[model samples]
Target: MAWEQVQKALKDHLGDSIYNLWIDPLECVSYRADEVRLACPDRFYRAHLDRNHLATVQQIVTELSGNDCKVILCDKETAILPAAQPKGQLRLPHIPERKSVVRALHPRYTFDAFMLGESNLLAQSACKSMINGDDTVGSCLYINSSTGLGKSHLTHAVAHALLADSPQTRLRYVTAQQFASEMVRSIQSRSMDTFKSVYHDHCDFLLVEDIHSLQGKKKTQEEMNELLDALIKSGKRVILTANNAPRDLKGIDNEFRSRMGAGLVTTIQAPDLATRYRIVEHKAVQSGLNLEEDVISYISQQIQGDVRRIESALLSLSAKATLAGGAVEMDMVRDVVAEIVGLSTNLTTTLIGEIISREFNVSYKDLQSRSRKKVISFPRQVAMYLGRKHTEESLGEIGKVFNRNHATVLHAVKVVSELCRCDTSVRRQMEILDRKMAEM
Candidate 1:
């Protein structure tokens, strides 16, 4: 049960290969009467530890008759991870009194990294100005845009700017749903004081992404209202980003809606061809691809609509060409485009069969079969969502590909789309998968 004993057991059994592979990088995050905590430095570490190291540690504890043990891997970038002190302990540090330390800041998204133009210049300027004492003190700035138009980037940039002194600023950023869950935890633990202080009074700024996540949680909205009032009264600024503005947060109270709208509100419409081309150029530079003007325009026009989709297309195309030790050309780009938008990737029958199988979690024969079950229904819809989310194909076209009616395809897309929006686990999984599909 002692810290030294745990360390010795791990060192004795885990050996250099497994220890370095699984345990060495983690910090002994905490230990209370019934639980011990471990913290890893990044997502890769957390994934490996959770998959491989967790069982070994649990077995060791069970052998020694230790208290019920659990391993929680915290994202070091977020407030989720506890900082370790020297001497095998972690401090339960309160969110600091000074408002300079914040998590939820994506270091890759500074003003310098954001691809800005007319669409986001004002919002970007406000973000850049905030750290320099140029506070945009409005009730809230409402930024709404179609997915992948840099709203998340701008939100993180603002948080990073405000927390110019990393250790001193105590900013708390979360989706509205996470805000709700944390509020419940605060109430149960009788630590609402720390929760409110961390989320409200201790921070000079609050940034909430995906305000739509708050659509149905009334009790959480009430808690947020209190936090909002305390923050505004204290002259702190709050930044909110969502798919829609305050007036559209379904099921929210009217007064709370007004409170959100008391400041500047802006909506970013979907990109035009010109904006999409600019995005493709920016993306080409980001990806180290020297795209010709014609190539950029070709991709921009083809991908259309969401800037994120266009960039994704471009990055994936360029990555594929580079990996094959070939130059990026119209032909290379055209092949990728055809497959995603049509049936033109030169995929061998075996590879094409493999992809279809993975997409729907059905064997090629099963997909060809006539089974009607929840398992198939689920992955079929997931494949439809992928076709809709990742490719520029028409619904009818996607239906033909899946050998289903257009209406059925549309229904699958709708159900999966809604699930991705409300279901966090599904949302994260699809995001990762969508990224992978584009790369392929």
Candidate 2:
């Protein structure tokens, strides 16, 4: 009952996502008035817990047990070892044999490592359903999103879970380009049957990434269509990811697109502000960085959309702190944020206008023109919106860059904000521009 109480307290304090990722997997070895023991999944999990969570566990245990209780955390293997083993005997943890994979899966890309948010909850849930053999999700799933939005992460997670749960599962994970190249090699060597046989007969689960690359390749498309047909007929599970939806993909045949869209089609949107905060916190803890709350909030606010940018910023922060005698201050964080977002000192309204003009294919001078043409006016509005976001300029100051008034700049920001909420295409373009600005 005390253990249950501790679990409830942890869930309440740390929130569901963090609790599920770290604490929920832990097994209770024993509990007593003065001592409690917990078993972690492995050395990696145990080390992380000891570094980040052990003190919290000890405090909670002491309060619940009404004594100065000591908490012992060890790997599952050590917890389950024979009681007769000699005292202080060294034992190496047993490691499972690695499963064969076409491309090595990242060890940290498993489902537990994925941060759930409003933008990606559906995609994550659907992947979990497919892996759990829930019939509602069907046998095929397609996830589409822009770069660095966790498309590959989810696919790798599915593969990792499958092989771990069912080691004998004949899984084939490859990119669309890799699949096309292998097919070409098979044809060149006059051994197409062997290639077909490998996917058709030997595979139980198939994962293909970046199906957008298969566009305009008719022969590859034909072979892929036939392969999908065979795999589906045999009730094999398949997952494919791309940067575009099936119907939106260019140069892809209708039948092949139909197959891709047959089961479930999900898209991952950019993380919202709250989700971005959680991501920043989670990454900082994982990297063993003792960043202050204000630092985390600042990074989350500045770095939008891409998860990779956050990682890069944190890594840079860590290096800088180490060089400066391990002190992280607000000024250091500001410099890191500016560097990651590609702002030299600050992002000027002029630079924002130029980037928008180039992206919208309108001349920079035209943006400052009085023309009401949709092409010219739309880009000007976007520039105004971005200027308000990336610079400390007032609305009037931002409007001066476009030869417009503060009222016009404010209206542009409002209109573009609403459009980003209602229109997927608009939101996607903004995400692209956001990335471009960060990389500039």
Candidate 3:
């Protein structure tokens, strides 16, 4: 069978999500009798497929070609680095090269519009400095946090602020997925020169969101690495957002991850209960609806983590009230809460430990172990606090999960509570971790 047929067969066997995130980035560069060579964009992709999917690929190749075939996977040669293009007037091909436009900025996501709580105060300040011409913050700033935490909002606000100050400032904002798709298209069209020219020559400031989404696309990863190097070398500003920290990112190249970490790295924590209440009220006013205090309080308690979910609940209640021809009361709010909160499954302490561990880059074993090290001890305290807050587990029950006495759990809970009141950073960390556990 033809290589195209094999490709189609594999894509059909694996679903779109798996294929696109993993297999679609591969290029079958050469083939011989019973042996096929696949060129991947980077070493990480080659290792990933070799470990997880190569056996299945071999099976598919055998079924397709009616013979046992050997699959050799390796990184694509860097010799295709666009120096071969003849120096002269450019020629337009019959088919146009693919391109993606940056997503439009949300008008509501201005700096003044963003609600400032302790959770996002630092991030907000950093972003303001960037807008105010503080180039000392380094050319690359990485902002990472769980979903609905305001990374996107901050980036959008930065764009608006920059443009407001100087409309002629050239900026481009795209999700990591868009950049990866464009990279794939450029490879297909053999027009990488055009891709490099667009990013290096056109963008004065570039912001990419959800960069964690570019996990398995090594070519796109390499392309982004190059783009970042060029932009930073030329003193152009670049900002990137992801769900997790650079050190926690799996399947990304080490050199690229180091570059991401070399600059300022900041996280947006989940909002605390009071902050959630404020958010509901803020969003309520923005939606032009008046919500009762009791109703807002009820939502503040029920919707655990995601501000987006809180906004969604408010929208639903507002819509329902409009349809029912009545004000939003506690009963209506309870109904909305049930509808929204019921969708989330109950969380487990084991899961909570995992999320906190990943967020702090502490090992799960260390978290549960009896270690008095400040780093491990504090995360353990936060875990204990989260356990009491998010789960139905009693203090003694939670103690069993952490291999401690009930009094120990209680002490941990107290310490974290006090720290939350005193340390803004600790408070924000708990807020973000609690939501991630509850949402998970």
Best by lDDT: 2
| Candidate 2 lDDT tens digits, 315-334 | 99999999999899989988
TM-score, each model?
A: 0.55, 0.58, 0.58
Give candidate 1's TM-score. Answer: 0.55
Off by over 4 Å in 1: 1-104, 135-139, 165-167, 339-440
Candidate 2: give the clashing pairs: none
**Comparing 1 and 3 on TM-score, the stronger one:** 3
Off by over 4 Å in 2: 1-100, 344-440
Candidate ranking under TM-score, highest first, comes to 3, 2, 1
Whole-model Cα lDDT per candidate? Answer: 0.65, 0.82, 0.76
Q: Per-residue lDDT for 112 in model 3?
A: 84
Tens digit of lDDT per residue, candidate 3, span 48-102? Answer: 9899888767766654343457888878974122125457655355322222234
Kindly give the stretch of ten consecutive residues in candidate 3 with the minimal lDDT sum. 93-102
Per-model root-mean-square deviation over C-alphas: 21.3, 19.9, 18.2
**What is candidate 1's lDDT per residue for 2-115, written digit by digit as tens?**
444455566666677887666776676565445667777888878877887677676554333223566456655652444454594343555333323334466777777776
